[model samples]
Target chain A: MTDKPRFKSARESGYLLCIDCEKLHPLSLEGELCDRCGARLHSRVPNSMNLSWASLIAAVILFLPANMLPIMTFKSFGQGEPSTILGGILHLLDQDMLLIGLVVLFASIVVPVLKIIAMTILLCTVQFRLQTNLRQKTLMFRIIEWIGRWSMLDIFVIGILVALVQLGNIAHIEGNDGATAFAVVVLLTMFSAIIFDTRLIWDNGVTDLPSDNSDEKDTP
Target chain B: MHGTPEQLIACHECDLLMTRVANKPNEDVICPRCHARIFYTSINSIERLLALSVAGLILFIPANIFPILSLQVFGQSQSEIILQSALSLFDGGLVLVALLILLFAIVVPLFQQVILFYISFTLHYRREGRLLRQAMHAYQHLRGWGMLEIFMLGVLISIIKLKDIADLHIGLGLYSLAALIVVTTLSSVFFNPHQIWHQIDLRRQKRATDDR
Candidate 1:
């Protein structure tokens, strides 16, 4: 005696809703503009996977240089040293600025890695149509989207440092290639997450009309 | 909850035909099929959003114009305001980084707050739905690009990193920058565009029924 309807989705009932305006139109009106808001109504975003894969692969490729090349160059008294992301963190740790060092470590290093890995897992789940953990996958996407932007912190810090630390023969900080690569990496990951429609993950599993949403089979 | 077919809302995350349900204040209505948060029923969404965005717009001015920090290196001292700090990168031959700073830290933040203020204010006074819709779209698209909070963290990290290299003094701009970051973040969390869209839906439906 469940109250839920047989049609699991508006798509199943041959309807597509405007995401912005929340107005439902028949699926046949796919290419037509939503009269209320003018957003082109589609049952689903076309080619969401292909674009997500492209952005993700590019981010993975750029992640190498983002970590390997020097992120910033600090020069003092005619001596210059270029430091990578990890090198900078080590330098801070060497100075016994443990708290700030950990902060940088989390934002610069951990967050990107976490975002890339999480995005990959999400893509695979949808790509293979893995029916399990559909809800968990959506939650993961939200977490990554919210935290993904914070990875820009390191580059902003470097920008300010490069701006403020110029002194002839005393101290100077220079911007480097790694900063650009890192910024690109962050941007690409953000693009990938945005392009991915989390709805696709449920298309494989949500067909069952009476499925309990809280399928805590994998909960700890 | 409205039972009209026009009231049917689809889940963007799962494509479920979610029934229209009354939203209790300070609660969330999530899609059952995918657990995507379909509605964040923030009470007084427009009023709260207006207050927060107004505070952010005010703070944005001083946060950009006032000197943020002054650094003493050997016998030389250089002071920087937020806007000039980003612009000065052009002189150092870091045009790309400079542009990034100007964009993510400067242009986007101002535009976002202004757009939010406009949308909330206009919607508050029952302005044209078409204009409010356009502003709403821009606000949504601009959400991901603004980085004032990240910029604040950068300011803190840069201050610490410079301690071993130079003497530093925090300025009014830094404090304003901190305050601006907080207000904008609160603006983002508390402002929900869904409420505006729902209001638009109500008007459209009422118009349809009245024409009958």
Candidate 2:
């Protein structure tokens, strides 16, 4: 019998202890390994980063059409109106919805492209182990991850328009080919941010987690 | 090192460092040595969102005031409403479009920015401090409402269709929107969630030591 470390041993019914660490919580967990760290208690998904990277690449390619093509179609009095990202903003200005126009232009156009570029840079640095501004690079990663979802604002609006403005022969709103690609761009970035770990930023060509005081050591 | 089919293995990251009696696949546990989270926890959430909120606030001014689009049809030209595009939709009897625009483009971003600023600064400056749980709850609620990109997509589609039927022209507002998007994206990417978590841990540790 092993005399494990003296942690509070639970004697409650239905409580099973982990033999290696000898800690107890609940039983019938999904895996054999600890879920937090890669201890061989159970098996789980591996190559998560690789899969995320592939998906991110696919999304990036699709981003071209998302930005370049017409996302929605307008039919009023039997005349067809098609607008790309730029045209929509201009149309808003023409209609005097100055603020809203600016918001759309910035959120949909500028943000997504910049995010792609930033992510590509971050991924490259991480993969190739480049000596660059680690702090600034990490900051850029955080920015991309947070704003990934809001880019779907246009898709959501289109969905609403298509759903709500179904007044046949008077006015109609329809989705276009670019919508699908746009959706992919949004979904990809969202997943890419979720899957990619920011901890890698602090890594200095080494696999282990950086020590907290390493920042002090790294500079001087 | 006794090997058994039911032998337990302990995880290094779990708070309750448990040993696995059975060799199960992908079964993660916490470590006894540290209160590190296990089983795929996001390193940072609030801090990342806060960065976006700040960017949104900064971009909000330009988004609201700039013109989104312009129209020239039949030698007579016009433009679309930005925030009030929804109002125009309503006037044109597209009530839902108007409401969606107002909610996502205007109201949501504004709410998220204000609340996020208050929470982060409060935590940062070491205020007498409201409950962390309460603050996190508000953040979660506010986070879901702001929908910037969706509104942008709508604007894009509108322009494309409008161009075919009418002569469309770009304006200063269009440029502003492009800038807003870039700022928001960068804000989200640059923020780190782990940093905030570290601050909280330091604070808690300090409290515990003071108690001792």
lDDT tens digits, residues B73-117, model 2?
455545443665555445555454456567766776676566666
| lDDT per model vs. reference | 0.82, 0.55
Error of 1 at B7 (Å): 4.6
**Residue B28 displacement (Å), model 2:** 27
Give the per-residue lDDT digits (tens) of candidate 1, residues B67-186.
899999767998888777567666766677678788999999999999989988877876655677778778887888999888888889988888876799998999999999888889
Cα lDDT of model 2 by residue, A94-126, tens digit: 977787677777777787878778877877876
DockQ agreement of candidate 2 with the native complex:
0.07
| Fnat values, candidates in order | 0.56, 0.09
The regions of model 1 sitting more than 4 angstroms off are A1-7, A209-220, B1-4, B201-212
Deviation from native of the Cα of residue A197 in model 1, angstroms: 0.6
Top candidate (TM-score): 1
lDDT of 1 at A22: 65
Candidate 1 CAPRI assessment class: acceptable
